[model samples]
Target: MHQSFISYKNFKSLKGSVVLCAAVLGLYVVAEPSATSAGGTWLGYVGGCLGGVLMVWLACLGIRKRKYKNTELLAVGWVSTHIYLGTALLLVVSLHSGFHLGLNIHSLAYAFTVMVILTGFYGLYAYSIYPDKITLNRDGMSRDSMFAEITEIDEKSLALSEKISPEMFAKISENVEETKIKTSLLTRLFSDRSLKEGAIYKAIDFVREQHSGSELIKELDSLLQEKESLVGKIERDIRYHFRLGWWLYLHVPLTVGALLSLLIHVYVVLFYW
Candidate 1:
C-alpha cells in the first residue's frame, strides 16, 4: 500500500483543507453580512486574506522544489499542501466574493485562479499515470539502444534488398533516406506516422507482393518486421515522454497569469475598496 502525495501523512493535508473550508464557511454564515460581490465585509476580508496567503504559498512551491537540499521543507509535504490548500483556495475565495463573479478585475482574478487550479489538477493526474507508462514502455531497453538496433536493422535490410534486385535496393534506399527516426517536436508530439513510413515497412510490402517465398525474401522480410517492431516501440516512447510533460506548457503560463492577477487584485482591494 504505497501512499501518494494525495494520501500523504494519512491525508493530513486534505483534513486540514476540509477544516479550513469549514471554518471559513461557518464564519461566512455566522457573520451574515450584506450579500455583496466585493470583499467589503469582515468575513469577506478574512476569507480574502486567507485565500491570498494560501495562493502565495502555493506559488512558492516551485522555489521549494528547486531547493532540493532543503530538508526542512520536504518536497512531498510541500506538494501535498500545495494540492489540498490550492483546492481549498477555491472555496475560500468563493466565500470571500460571495460567489458573485462579474466582468471586472475581481472576476478576472477569480477566473485565472480557477484556471490555474484546473491545470494543477491535470498535472497531478498526468504525473500519477504517465511515469509508470513510460517505465513500462521502455522496459529494459534504453532509447539509444533501441535506436541503434533500428539503425542496424536498416543497414541489414538494405544489404538484403540489394541481393534481391535493383528495384528492391532502390526502394529500400529511398525509404531509408525518407525514414526520419529523429523528427521534429511537433511530429513527435502529434503523429507516430514516421513508424509507418520506414524502410522496413516498404521492404516488407515489396517482399510480400513482388517476390516469391524464397529463403532470401523470407530473411529480408524477417529483418524488416523486426525493424518495424523496434520503430513502433521508439514511437511509443517518444509519445509517452511528450504526453507526460506537454501540460506544463499550459500550466506554467496559467499559473503566472493567476499570480499576477492576484497581486493586482490585492492592491486594488486594499487601495480602492
Candidate 2:
C-alpha cells in the first residue's frame, strides 16, 4: 500500500514556518508601537507586506501544480511548503491587523482573508488523508476492470440459478440481482451495505449451507462474495474522491472573496490613507 502524506517531510515545512513565525514575533515584541499600536506602525506595515506576498505565493501553488509535473521540480515538496507557509500566513496576517478592527472595509477584508486561510487548511487536511486511502483500497486494478469482473460474475450467477429448483431459483435470483446492481448515492456516502449486501449475503448463506453438497452452489456463493468485496472497494474509492474533491468547492470561492477584499482594501487605503 502507498503511504500517507503525514510523514516527517510534510511536517518539516511546519517546523521551518514555526521558526520563522517565532523570529517575527520576537521582532514585533521588541519594536515599540505608536500610541495606536496599529498597522500604521512600522512592524505592522512590514507584517502587512509579508502577508500580502504570502497570499500571492499561496495562489501560485495552483500554477505550480498545473505547470510542473513529471520533472525534477519537486511537486510534492512544493505542496508541503505551500501548506505550511499558508499556515504561517495566518499568524502574519493577524499580526498585521494588530488585534484592532473597525466596522469598515478593513475589517471586511480581514474577515475574508481569514476565510481563505481556513478553507486552505481544510484542503490541506484532505490532501494529507484521502489519496492514500483511495490508493490502498484500489489495489492494482482499475475501477473499470473491477466492474467488468462484477458484470461477468453476475451473468454466471444468473445462468447457474436456472439449473436449481424453482423455489431455490427465486430466492437466489434476488441475491444475484442485489449484488450486481450499481450502488446508490446514499450507499456511497454512508455505509449502507448492511441493508443491501448484508441482506443478500444472509439469504445466500442460508441456502448455500442447506444444500452444501452441490458444487455449483458453493462456487456461486464464493463468486457472489467476491463481487461484494469488489463493489465495496469501488464505493470506498468513490467516497475518497468526494472527500478530496469537495475541498476545492469551498476553497475556490473563498479565494475569489479574498482577492476582491484585497482589491477593495488597496483602493480604499490608497484613496484615504
Candidate 3:
C-alpha cells in the first residue's frame, strides 16, 4: 500500500510538472517579439497561449488520473494545482490583453476565460470547505442513519397516536408522511414552508381542545418533542446542501466555458498566425 501510494504521488507530481512546464513554454513562445512585431500584440498571444496550454494540461491530467487510478492525496494535489494555475492563467491572459477589452471574438474569448477562472475559484473554495462543513453539520450523525432513526420515531409516534384522539393521530400521520419525503438535504433546505412548525402547532392546538387529560396527550407531547429534534437535524442537512449546490452551478459552467475559450484561442493562433 505504501509503495502504491508513493507511485500515485509521483505520477500526480509528474503530471502537474508537465502541465506547468507546457504553460511556461507556451507563454514564452507567445511572448517572443517575432510573432507580434508589427502590432505589439505579443501580450495577447502569450496570455492566450498560456491559458490554452493550461486548459489542455488540466484536461489531460483529469483523463489520465481517471483512467489509471484513484488516489485521495493525488486528487487533492491535482485540484490544488488546477485552482492556482487557473488563477495564474487569468492574470497572464489579462496582462496579455494589456487590459484592453473590446467588441470582438478575441475579447469575448478573453471574457469567457475570466468567467471560467472566477467560477473555478468559487468551486475551489467550495471543494476545500465543504467536507468539513458537511461533517460539522452532521453533528456526528450519518444523514442516512439519521433518516432511519426518524423513521423509527415515526413508527413509535404512529403507535402512540392510536391511543389518542383520531384527529391528532391523523395529524401525526400527515407529518410523518411529509417528513419521509423530505429525507434528502436539498429538499429540507429549500422547502419554502416549515413542516415541523406546522405539525407542532396543529398538534398543540388539537391536544389542548380534545385530549387535555388523557395518557395519550402525554405520549403525543413526547412525540412532538422528538419531531422537533428531527426537524432541526433535517434543517442542518438542508443548509449543508444549499452551500454545496452553489459550487456545482459555478464549476460546471465555468469548466465548459474554459474549454470553449481554449479551443477558440488555439484555432485563432493557428489560423491567423
Best by lDDT: 1
Ranking by TM-score: 1, 2, 3
- Across 179-207, the per-residue lDDT of candidate 3 in tens digits comes to 54344455544544544456655665665
Residue 18 of model 2 has an lDDT of 93
Q: For residue 231, what is the lDDT in candidate 2?
A: 72
Candidate models: Cα lDDT each: 0.81, 0.74, 0.64
Q: Which ten residues in a row have the lowest lDDT in candidate 3?
A: 1-10
Model 2 per-residue lDDT tens digits across residues 125-201: 77777777888989988888888887887777777766766766676667665554346666655543532466457
Q: What tens digits encode model 1's per-residue C-alpha lDDT throughout 1-273?
A: 556888889999999999988888788777777755457887778888888888889989988999979998578889998999999988888888887788888888888888888888888887788778778877889999998987887788789888989998898787677776566778766664645645557667878887587887888778877777777788878877887778778877777888788889889988876
TM-score of each: 0.86, 0.81, 0.71
Q: Evaluated with TM-score, which candidate comes out highest?
A: 1
Which ranges in model 1 have alpha carbons more than 4 Å from their true place?
1-3, 34-38, 181-195, 198-200
* Ranked by lDDT, top first: 1, 2, 3
Error of 3 at 258 (Å): 2.4
Query: How far in Å is the alpha carbon of 69 misplaced in model 1?
Result: 1.2
Residue 111 displacement (Å), model 1: 0.8
